[model samples]
Target: MIEHRRIAHSLVWSTVALGALALTGCATTDKGGSSNLPTPDAYAELRDARGADRGRVDIFRDSSGLRLEVVARGFGPGTYGMHVHAVGQCAAPDFSSAGPHWNPTGAQHGRDNPMGAHHGDLPNLVVESGMIGRATLHMVGSRLTGEGGLLDADGAAFVIHAGPDDMRTDPAGNSGGRVACGVIATPAG
Candidate 1:
């Protein structure tokens, strides 16, 4: 189990690193002329089944793609599978309203599958004993609006699962039940 966790961590980080590299071309100089980065675009507020506060997810967008950052707390100490679901609704008590993983390209689940990796596939979230977890990911060829946008008519959502994503299974990677969810929405300020 310990080794498996380590492997998962490595794979996830590697994927993130590659995604970051891919975004380099779309980047520009920072305010201090240091480095280019994705700009903040939208966000979401996560809640559990009973509507308890969980955390927040922020979305950043560049010319070519979008990035997601999830900062959450009040979870048990362990790794959990986090994903972007198709529907934006996060109805309480079950979060089934969020629907399944966002797969506009008709791909399978997980980054490790031979013929898989839906656009919604994300790294596993690891929470330490402090009960807090954070993860950042860049999804290439995705947008917040326009054709095939995440905020289309049906909308989209972020969901945290009860178990770790095996990163190779079909569908949801057998990540267990939906523990928390949030609807992606643009800020109104």
Candidate 2:
């Protein structure tokens, strides 16, 4: 009888340990449907021309596509054009150092263009009374890693323009001057 009691106790403890391990495995896979991809592969810290912290952008990779989460503040209330520029530099005031819009496939400038749009053209961002806004954008032709990734070679940048993107013009959608900029890079582990 003593030996039987000891075996039963050991069985109960083993069952409890297995249950705990299963629960932990489920918790780690709760990232929507991205069970196979890394949560956030890259990040960008955005700033105004004065070099003050505006907000940040996080890039995530999943089986469906690439996801970009942009959060920003401290601008005047209005709609602004935003895009990924070709270069990584974010010189103050004009931000010309960031170069033109990212166009890896050599596509045209706007989403409304018949020839096709540039890889960097994103939706317009609207700021409310407190000058704050956040948006999540998804893309099928881009990724945060390898080959034509946003962090490739010359790198890329997020840029905010003074005017709205007309969605049909060439070169830059006549978005006017760049108001804010941020360079995209892989976050340090």
For model 1, the run of ten residues with the poorest summed lDDT: 29-38
Candidate 1, lDDT over the whole model: 0.87
lDDT string for model 1 (41-159, tens) is 88888999988889988898976688888888899899999999999999987889999998888998989988859889988999987888988888888888888889999999999
Worst 10 contiguous positions by lDDT, candidate 2: 28-37
Note the Cα lDDT for every prediction shown: 0.87, 0.83
TM-score of each: 0.77, 0.76
Model 1: how far is 86 from its true place, Å? 0.4
lDDT of 1 at 133: 94
> Tens digit of lDDT per residue, candidate 2, span 94-129?
889999998788889888999878789998988887
Q: How displaced is residue 33 in candidate 1, in Å?
A: 24
